[model samples]
Target: MLKTTSQVRALTPDDLPELHLLLDRDPLVNLFVRNRVDSTRLQARWLGGQVWGYFEDGVLVSACHAGTNLVPVQATRKALRAFAERVLGDNVRPSSIVGPRDAVLPLWELLEPRWGPARSPRLAQPFMVLDRDSRLTPDPRVRPVLIDEFDTIYPACVAMFTEEVGVDPEAGSRSGYRARVAQLISQGWAFAIIEDGQVLFKTEVGAATPQACQLQGVYVHPDLRGRGIAGPALSAVVRLVRQTVAPVVTLYVNDHNTPARRAYERVGFEHTETFASILL
Candidate 1:
């Protein structure tokens, strides 16, 4: 007999080891890579409603996690419904819920229709994956943010978010976003291309694991695209990451983003998986 329960809940620190192994073993997870997660980070992320998992025999077997940018469109939908029905007992509404691709899918598949068309897919944004290898060279001008560059780097970070994620890092205060940028700068996590006197290109390593670092907020100014900038700029960022963290780097791109994908491939990234997002 197959047994199941929605009483299952979000992953806890104690479940980290098991969850990590389960995620690592899944081929689909190769797109995100599994090493970036640990107990503490998972807890913080989960508390934000970005993660949920299922356990069996005291070991975490299945989990669907979401990030700030992408939610699990299918998995989360399934997991949440199962949880609500078995644990909450039908007190919740039947309306569709959406979030990042990784966060929602587990819930989406828990009942029936394990795989089907997305109810509300974010078609404009497609999932992309990049693998790190030595294909391009780092730009001499591009380097990690230094202690003195916060004033300038801060604005660039905000501009990156506005262009990439479509929301201000602070949602309002430009200064607040600056402060958040400052934090990443201090940690040696942010990078930029400095030419003459201004920033030209930039990207951030959103989640870094021993296995891989997920690239996020990659952007070049509108006029700067196809100017032989992205190739070297991305090369520099990936090179730096290989030096400090995982040698493999990855990022999600929209399926329709042909140009970006080509640029990434030129810099030594490969497509490893397809991911869909749910927006509720």
Candidate 2:
């Protein structure tokens, strides 16, 4: 039966232990939240927003990271309703609602009436993972993007973001996006294959834990999309990432992206779960 006695409130540092336990339930899928908590330790000054916890008779059963991404952690049906209530009551509107399909779908259903008409709702996203070297030969040319190659990598990233997300990231934060790309390169999280002065293939480790890491900004040059650059390049990524970043590399792609999924499969990534996103 659904627990009747419950309380939902914004979490604090004191709640970190329970929060950690909850987030650890699925580290690969929860890497983004885990990374944020590890870095900020639930500090609002750093987190920029709150993570709400759903408690049943004094035990944290689930949580929702309310910020640029409204991500749910091990959310139950009851928890989703409570979280929706809290969000609406406080008038909190996140840029996106995303997480595991089971949790994200129900929560969005609860919020869509008021938050109705999402700008872009991606309902079927395959959450894929690769924990070992790919069967395909790694593309030897793909390597960590050097700081000097910032000019070469930046345009590819913008194009990928615009094509994938349907909006130019530079449209909002001109400098912010550039700094992020630079930061990822400096940290050795960004990888690319550049020839002369052009980026042929590129991707980045968007988030990570010691257990696993999530990749984003995967792209193949527009003019060269059909020549099968993604799979081999990602083979290189999986190999290098397993050696340097984490054992498991994960990413979620829209279910409709056939070529991307096929390329990921060619690199030996298997679909482990379904995720959804409601972009606001």
Candidate 3:
């Protein structure tokens, strides 16, 4: 194994170039961090998280974002071990650990004893991406959500979050969660198909940078699902994202969600990588 005086430290704006280079090595998979980096660089508060770098002879080899979510990028066995040790000792408790399957699983294995069992471990999430316009026709009804629609959209957003994450977004208080939904709408990142103030389908461009944007919180009302709605709605969202937000759109789906997987395939998404998440 390559050996040098390994040093791990919190990254700062001065490390931007090195960090950007490392993250760009796998831009699609690293979109989560790259989006934050593009907006806030190496600020400790970027996306409410701090980034740490593992350096060998002053060259960054691996990096991790520790906060609401734990994401390790390009971490080798040594780097993962070091990160696990560092975060465990510091008493940092992230809500979840997510990343490329190969990296997340091993990192979770190292930290599980210290962090306790995850509430759920999603071991196979196909990280899919789309660069070209979708093959399916875009849904004419789906459009960017208006700021005035936050009240109508909030419930759907909460429901989707709870269903997907297995925890109510409004469990503690609705104010904070409500504000987040409004923010996405204000930023023109929220989209939905609504009629009579009822959200039929909804989603958001949860994270973005010039190179790519990630789609999240995709939900079609229970009453509206399985009737050929998601495929075209998603294609519309993908089209809007490619036209106005970024050229590339990416999302990860639970491997077991064969229907969603097929729907995305119908929309022109292809599996680019695999991801895993240890939800705490």
Candidate 4:
């Protein structure tokens, strides 16, 4: 039964133990939150966002990262309702609301009436993970993007972002977007296959904690598609990521993308959970 004294309030560093337990319930799915907490330790001022907790009888029943991304982790229905009410009242403008399918959809239903329609609502995203290498062959050319190749790799990154998210990353300012891409490359998170100054394939370790690293911005140049290049490139990426970045690698794909799913399956990624993303 739902507790009567439940209240939604900002979580603090003192809440770390309980928060860790809650997030550790599904580390792969909750890696974003885990990474945020580990870096900020729930410090309200430094977190660059607020981590709110739903407490019932002094126990944290659910947690929400209310920032650019309105992410809920292990939220109960009661907690979701409380979160929707809180964000609605506060008028929080998150770029997206994303999480496990069960929590995200119900929470969106409560907020949509007031928040209006999303630009695109991805109702089914297969959250997949790989802890070991797959049967697919790894491409020898797949490697970390170098700093000198920033200019060469930037356009491909923008194309991938625009294609996948349906919006131009450079819509606001080209310099800013270019800098972001440069930062990813300088940090050694960006990977690609470059052939004579053209990036044939690209991806990045968007988020990583000690437990797992989440891949994002996966793309193959249009000309390279259907040449049987993606599978081996991705397999090489998975192998490198597991060896150097994290023991396990994870990513979520739009359910309807059969070719992407089949390619990931070839890389030995297995479905672990369902995720929903509402792009605002």
Question: What would the TM-scores of all predictions be?
Answer: 0.74, 0.96, 0.97, 0.95
Write the residue-wise lDDT of candidate 2 on 51-94 in tens digits: 99999989999999998889999999999999999999999988
> How accurate locally, in lDDT, is each candidate?
0.60, 0.92, 0.91, 0.91
Cα displacement (angstroms), candidate 3, residue 138, comes to 1.2
Candidate 3 regions exceeding 4 Å error are: 1-3, 45-47
Tell me the RMSD of model 1 versus the true structure: 5.4
Question: Best by lDDT, which number?
Answer: 2
Instruction: List, residue by residue over 45-69, the lDDT tens digit for candidate 3.
Output: 5457788899989899999988878
How well does candidate 2 score on lDDT at residue 188?
97
The deviation in Å at residue 273 for candidate 2 is 0.5
Error of 4 at 123 (Å): 0.4
Clashes of each: 32, 0, 0, 0
Candidate 4's residue-wise lDDT over 129-211, tens digit each? 99987678899999999999988988898899899889898887889788878877887899999999988999999888899
Name the TM-score of candidate 3. Answer: 0.97
* Model 3 pairs whose backbones collide: none
* Worst ten in a row by lDDT for model 3: 40-49
